[model samples]
Target: PEIKSWIDTVLYDSACDSQPLKDKFRDQLGIALEASLNPRRKKTVTENLPKGMKKLTAYGNLVCNA
Candidate 1:
C-alpha cells in the first residue's frame, strides 16, 4: 500500500544519520543562541563626573574597587 510504503520511507529516513543536519543547524544558530543565553552587558560611562579634587578621589576609588 502507498501508506505502508510512505511509513517505511519515513522510518528509513528517520533512522539515517542526522549529524549533518544537526551540525548545519548549530552552525547557523550557535552564535545567536549563545549570545541570547549568555548576553554581555555594555559598560556605561559616568557622564557627570565630579569636577575637581573629588574627581581624583572618585577615579581612584573606581580604579581600586575594580
Candidate 2:
C-alpha cells in the first residue's frame, strides 16, 4: 500500500535495492516507483453522435480556441 500512496501523491525517493550512486541516474532522469511504472485509470468511453449519423465529427464543436 505504501507504493500506491507514493504514486497517488507523485512521490518518489531513489530506487529500491539500488546503490546511491551506482549509475547516477536520478539526476539525469528521475525517481521511478514501481507503482508509477504501471498505472491504470478506470473510466467509460463514449462516442457522442447525432441521432442518426454514420460519420464522426472532424473536430469538437466546443470551440477550443475561443
Candidate 3:
C-alpha cells in the first residue's frame, strides 16, 4: 500500500517530478528492509505461479536486476 500511495502522490502532484518521488520511495524501502531480519533474500519461494504471471514475473525480475 505504501508503494501505491507513493505512486498516487507522485502521479497527482503536478509540481513534483520523478526523482523526488523515487528518492522518497527509496528511503521508505530502505527503512522497511532495515526493519526486516534478512533484508537480502526472500523467506520462501512461491510453489505455484501467481495470478497475472507475466506481470508478476516481470516485476520480480526487475527488482532482482535493480
Candidate 4:
C-alpha cells in the first residue's frame, strides 16, 4: 500500500518538487508506468476462419501507437 501511494505521489509530483525525491522514485515509477500502459489479454482461436490458418494462439501485449 505504501509503495502504491508513493508511486501515485511521484507520478503526480510537479517540477517544483525537490530533485532527490524525483530521483528516488524514478526507477520504480518507470516500471509501474510501463506495466500499466502496456496491457495484455488472452486470445482465442475459433473455427470460423478460412482453412489453413495456424491455430496456435500466443499470449502477449498488443501495443498500439496513435
Candidate 5:
C-alpha cells in the first residue's frame, strides 16, 4: 500500500522526478489497472475509473476526493 501511494504521488507530480521513472510507473499502473478490470470484480473492462487510480474503490475515493 505504501508502494502504491508512493507511485501515485510520484505519478501525480511529474516535475518532481525523472520522466522515465514517471513513465515507467504510469505504464505499470495502466497494466495493473487493465488487469484489475478483468471481470472478477463484477466490473467490466469498460468500467470507468478515474484517470490514474488502479483499484475500483480507490478509483472512487480518488475521484470523490478530487
Candidate 6:
C-alpha cells in the first residue's frame, strides 16, 4: 500500500508538470498550421515597378519597353 501511494503521487505530479508543456506544444502547432494554411503574400519584383511599367506579357513575363 505504501508503494502504491508513492507511485500514485509521483504519477500525479508528473501529469501536473506535463500539462503546461503540452499546452505550449499545442499552441506552437496551431500557429504553424495557421501560417501554412494562410500564408503571407511576398512582394514580387514587378509589383514594385511604376504604374506604366507594370506590364506583363501574355506569358507573364515583364515587358519593359521603356
Q: Give the number of the best model, judged by TM-score.
A: 5
Q: Using Cα atoms with residue i matched to residue i, what is each candidate's TM-score against the true structure?
A: 0.21, 0.16, 0.20, 0.22, 0.23, 0.19
User: Regarding TM-score, does 2 or 4 come out ahead?
Assistant: 4
Candidate 3 residue-wise lDDT, 4-51, digit = tens: 443432223333435665566657653211121232444333445455
- lDDT per residue as tens, model 6, 27-56: 543211112211123333565666667665
- RMSD in angstroms, all models? 16.9, 12.6, 13.5, 12.0, 14.0, 16.9
What ranking of all candidate models by lDDT puts the best one first? 4, 5, 6, 3, 2, 1
> Which structure is stronger by lDDT: 1 or 3?
3
Predicted candidate 4 versus true structure: per-residue lDDT over 1-66, tens digit per residue: 356653553233233445555565565453222122112344545445455554434444233222
Model 1 segments more than 4 A misplaced? 1-17, 31-66
**Comparing candidate 1 with candidate 5, which one achieves the higher lDDT?**
5
* C-alpha RMSD of candidate 1: 16.9
Candidate 2 at 47: error in angstroms? 49
User: Mind giving the per-residue lDDT tens digits that candidate 2 earns over 22-66?
Assistant: 234344344442222212233222346344544432342222212
Q: Enumerate residue pairs that collide in model 3.
A: none
Superior by lDDT: candidate 4 or candidate 6: 4
Clashes of 6: 0
Ranking by TM-score: 5, 4, 1, 3, 6, 2
Better-scoring candidate (TM-score), 4 or 6: 4
Better of 5 and 6 by TM-score: 5
The global Cα lDDT (0 to 1) of model 3 is 0.39
Model number with the top lDDT: 4
Q: Which stretches in model 6 have alpha-carbon errors above 4 Å? A: 1-17, 31-66
lDDT of each prediction vs. the true structure? 0.34, 0.36, 0.39, 0.42, 0.41, 0.41
Name the candidate, 1 or 6, with the larger TM-score value: 1
